[model samples]
Target: MITNEQITAYNEAAISVLNGSAKNAKSRVKVFRVSQLIAQETIMESVDGLHLPESSRETSAMILMNVCCNKVVRPIDGSCCQPPSAPALTQKLAAGFFGLSIAGCLILHLVHRHGHRRSRPCADVEAGEEKKAAPAASACPSEVVLQSCCKLGLIMAYFYLCDRADLFMKENKFYTHSSFFTPIIYILVLGVFYNENTKETKVLNREQTEEWKGWMQLVILIYHISGASTFLPVYMHIRVLVAAYLFQTGYGHFSYFWIKGDFGIHRVCQVLFRLNFLVVVLCIVMDRPYQFYYFVPLVTVWFLVIYITLALWPQITQKKANGSCFWHLGLLMKLASLLVCICFLAYSQGAFEKIFSLWPLSKCFEMNGNVYEWWFRWRLDRYVVFHGMLFAFIYLALQKRQVLSEGKGEPLLPNKMSNVLLFVSVVSFLTYSVWASSCKTKAECNELHPAVSVVQILAFILIRNIPGYARSVYSSFFAWFGKISLELFICQYHIWLAADTRGILVLIPGNPMLNITVSTFIFVCVAHEISRITNDLAQILIPKESAALWKRLACMAGFFSALLLLSSIRGEHRR
Candidate 1:
């Protein structure tokens, strides 16, 4: 692998070329080619600095990636090209492509149209005029359409693969045979085929300044680990994913470090972080006693510190004034995804309880000190409700400050409609809280927890002012748990199967303390390692485009295998 030091030196060299190359480029292609050349030169310079065993194809592709990124075009006569004036048909098409509801799509269209006008002109005439245009402005509508269509095709192909795998897995579950390995094989095939073409794709190369590099590395590491855990079967993966997500949410508040203030993704992150804080906090408060886990509040403080540090220390938060509308659209998609998550959780909960009594609806209920729990030595529900509220209040205060700032360009208050909706949500939550307080049985309160969860869900939906999506800041584990979250949640129980303790692992072999320590270590390490290997091979061999399909199939296979394995062990023990 090329070293970082080499990359830096090459980048410095490429900068010199970029500074001097503006004089002679005629056609856009030529300019693009020049950029490509600079990128290639930089990569070559870096390659010469390090020894690697990579195939020639890989080296060439990397060089090509540099070339694609470095190219800069002079305008075609009149103005810097703005994506051909977006026709109404194109707007409609964009709406359809994004899977936005008609109303949501219309809202986006209006926002885009309004925002489009305010963008700097592609180019200015030489009558003492200066040109100012964002890089995304230069993108062609045809290119956007092509990419959208390609992504859709990929999704369809993936679903087809999944359906076949699901049917095949019904026969044998351990997944040690070729039929079970089909998806992995398919990914390896596709990765080899498409990895070469990836060089042709011109993904924006955001300048990796030191500050940006540090933050990106940290976030990406968390993302990688969290994603990897999805393939494992550890009970605590969900909780860990949640905690990491909270950390990510906290970090998102400082997005001014790289993106513009109005950047849609930045705003979406703001909303998500808020939502996550509420969920985690409320769960803490309404269910469980304060344990060492209460230190989660310290994250809120850390968030504040980072926000202040970024705002006050400009050196840490540099960004170009103009960036990409693509990023804004991306934000909208992410904001919309919260709805997808809620639906998924609801569906999964229903399916899990229906198929396996172990995951009963009551598993997610509020906890109370009771005789059964005392005898069983297990706490099914641990509430974090108060902590959630505390985090929300802090977030609200920070957001209010942002709104008050003159640089924000718009007032911070939710629109009039949003305010009315907020009022309704507050009323609903209060009424529910009052009703719940009057309840007696632990079962009754436990039953009510899901309902209360719905209220908060609705509130979050209202705040986003978008239907079927979460608007509140949510924990970052959504990204972290993208692949391996399910594995971590389920697989760790087998370690305890030997102890014949209930589904929950208790670490008392001959002695409770030693067993617990050994159990936790074994569980965490085994789960982490398993997830890491599964995800590592998948990451290397499978293109991200096919990851989702493979992940779903792999999970289904893993789940079935676990079920059969456990059943077989039980039978042997009975015999």
Candidate 2:
């Protein structure tokens, strides 16, 4: 309606204002490229802080936390395999337990010392010359509980510090599987120099078994730390080491029952307590499921299976009153029955899965509501225990017939017999190694694993025991490590390794050598302490007297009932 010049001037001014606004918006946004990807982000500073509404002085912590705790939602690749992280609840519980355990240990120690000093003065006056029996440390429930808690606290602190705070962790510290042989060489060099046992080592005796367990555990630790499972030959051999452990379980338990002729439930309970007390505590502390520590579950199940097999009707024992050929035949029949059942179970993965998926067992074993992992683990080592029983049967039969003997100054027949046995073992060893290396996949390796893993186990035993001096003397260094191998196995999943054993733990951060050295020292020391606590707890839990056993069992049942109730509540909350 107005003049053309005036209208044009109005429109130009409006256009200039719009352009300035667009420029300001562009300035607020940042565009960047990383490698092949590009993204845009808006940058801004905090205008106001978070605060809890209507909080008093006592509740002021809520406000502080609200303001201080900033969360960054880092996008992780959902498809790639990674370790589970600590949850908020896990961190809180772990922190509390850490504090209580450490402080409780110190306070209890002071109280115990003070009480002992007070008792000494009275004892000097009351008993002029007679010495009173010292109180049994194992009998004290308070000390055992405190020590166990202390063990848990220390380990949790190390785990929390290393994993969450990244105290000793370094980025991009990937393990090189190609360097596997280097550790073997160094370990062998060290092994040769360790002082030998003075006692004449019997076949599979404590010293011998300990040394065997030590070297095997060492290999397993190396295998896990280096992520060498991808290397076929090494992976397959490590599988054999695992099989050997199960073999020990069968042989040791069977030998104990047959030779000692003690099939009492207390013996079984003691063994279970020793094996699982630390693991159960860890399950609670680490907030991991029982199935998370795969090895213990595997070993535990096998132990139970072996126990049931021997404890069934017609108990066979060479040391028992009914120790005759018929009883020995009964042992063979039981072993055969076990093997047949194992074969049937192994024949169908679905059937195995269905069996383990049953209500109560599923709660213990299933990961993400599936037993695929358990099935894979269970089936791979299914027949190994039977092999152990068979081996024990044959060995015991031979010993009973006086064809073989154990102890000092006794040669296992002529030196030629030993040499021939050693030569055959070497052949079997190389043959298995070659075949294992040729496998393209783990499935293929596991297919023949049940049958051929025994080859490696037997070969190692023959090679170890065939030599005259080697049979007589053992390495004390390896034996020492062997003593705590179980603890090491369970503890390594947390502090020694990281991310539930998918990564190695770093304690020094910079130099890999120094880091490994320091971490290994701390790891060994912690494991040793854990081993002591486990022993002390086991001693108290499995009492010698019948009345005390029932009392302990009642207490344990109540404890478990409470745990189950809490777990149920947690599940309901999640739902």
Candidate 3:
């Protein structure tokens, strides 16, 4: 055993070296001071040992160096630093804006109430004659304006809370790989609590589609939360799920255009507004790039493609007086042409980048950013939506010929043909599973995904179409989640995952399970509210009976002008 006097001597020597080094270390003075204090504590605790082990001594030295280095390397950039106090003038302007928003909301609410009261006397007189009260008009212009202001203020407040107010702010940590069984457990729990859809429905009906989207979105959420992208199987499955969403997009848009044949500006605006409203709002409030929430842009682009292709072709737009075969041929030709265009873009990465990086969109990127990154991400499953459109055309054609009929309650194929379809589906499922399992890299998987994904998508469609499969096995619970799935996907980037989607924020530190539960609950609730707001806005922006053509055109122009001005102002502020 070492004597106390020797230990004391060793401590004295350590303290002298620490002080001399600290005196010499000018750049890392703070770190040295901290390290010296820690060293003194360690020495006191280890008094029985006259001399530290070689490894322990080395470790202590490393700890000291690291402490000093961390202090010296701490970030000084404005991006990570605590924001400086706002100028008095700027603070006054912010207060004014908040005051105006609140005042506007209250005034609008009062005006509405007054108007309702004024209209009541007339309704009462009519009530005596047994006439029903006229349906209340949609939310008035002032009310809409007030609602818009309130939403803007709420978003700004939320961003403040997340970033500067310290309410939601916390240390951001890189995502760690979670347990393999996490996703499995998530799915099982979701299934256990699933609310089955009991209403009669056709194969791939609205409810069924909703259920598909809901379940896929839920699974994707789980995948993201678990940080399971490092696991190849989970990664591949998530890819397939993303492909399924695009497939639904292709099917939904094509079916709507085919049946309604109304590709008006109003329809286009409504769809785009629904898809992009939340994302655009967040972009302004959070001061992020447009491409930050990319899914909306992807869907918007595809919708344009479908709309333009159908609206431009006379043969495709003609009524069904022409033979069904002719319609099918026209559709096939269009799809083939689309495929050719996609292939050409894929052949030349430069051309693809050039197209997406043009003019207004170029402004979305900060200095020195490469367009190729965006191009690569978009192209990975580029052809999946086209596959969906092709399938939709085939399905519709079969339905027109009465080969597939929900009303008849009959199988689309004879017993022998059904067996063949079933066999094909099983084979396709196995093939995709094997292919996904065997892939070793993202590039390899992306190269093979376009073709492999179709097999599984078709398998799911076929399986769902079996007599009672769609109606009897639907999940109402998943369908509800599906309705707000887009919001969840976009919002999670900032609110659920932090640091530009690279990490998670430590909220209720040291309790991962409770943190996740609380975060997810809050995330889901916010997403639902966002969806409701978007729907309400859509109703206001795209009413059923639109104004005259000239009026509508004028309104569109005015709206775009205002949006451009607002964007320019935001850009200047960011600078």
What is candidate 2's lDDT per residue for 372-419, written digit by digit as tens?
988888888888888887888787777777676465655665678877
Stretches of candidate 3 off by over 4 Å are: 1-99, 107-141, 163-180, 198-200, 315-322, 364-368, 405-412, 544-575
Model 2 misplaced regions, further than 4 Å = 1-102, 112-141, 164-178, 321-323, 405-410, 414-416
Q: How does residue 170 of candidate 3 score in lDDT?
A: 39
Ten contiguous residues minimizing lDDT sum, candidate 2:
35-44
Q: What is the lDDT of residue 129 in candidate 2?
A: 62
Ranking by lDDT: 2, 3, 1
In model 2, what is the error at residue 203, expressed in angstroms? 1.4
Give the TM-score (vs. native) of candidate 3: 0.77
Give the total clashing residue pairs for model 1: 47
How much lDDT does candidate 1 score? 0.36
Model 1 lDDT per residue over 338-456, tens place? 33543453445454234323322222221242123221111111112222322333343344345422121222244565467778877875775566556565555544453354454
- Candidate 3 lDDT at 323 equals 47
* Model 1, residue 534: C-alpha shift (Å): 2.6
lDDT of 3 by residue, 1-575 (tens): 66767866887777676666564456332323444354455665464654444555665676665445634554321122233233333334544775688778888789878987776734357456655568988867557756866765675566445543335533434334545466657666775487675465566788788888988888887677656887786688789888888888888898888877887778888898899877766664555666767677778878888888777756374255244666667777888988899889977888887876776666543233567666765677788888888878777767667785464355657767877898889888887788788889977888877777767888988877765444455677788888899998998876777655655644677787788778778778888877877887677666666565447558966865665566566557757
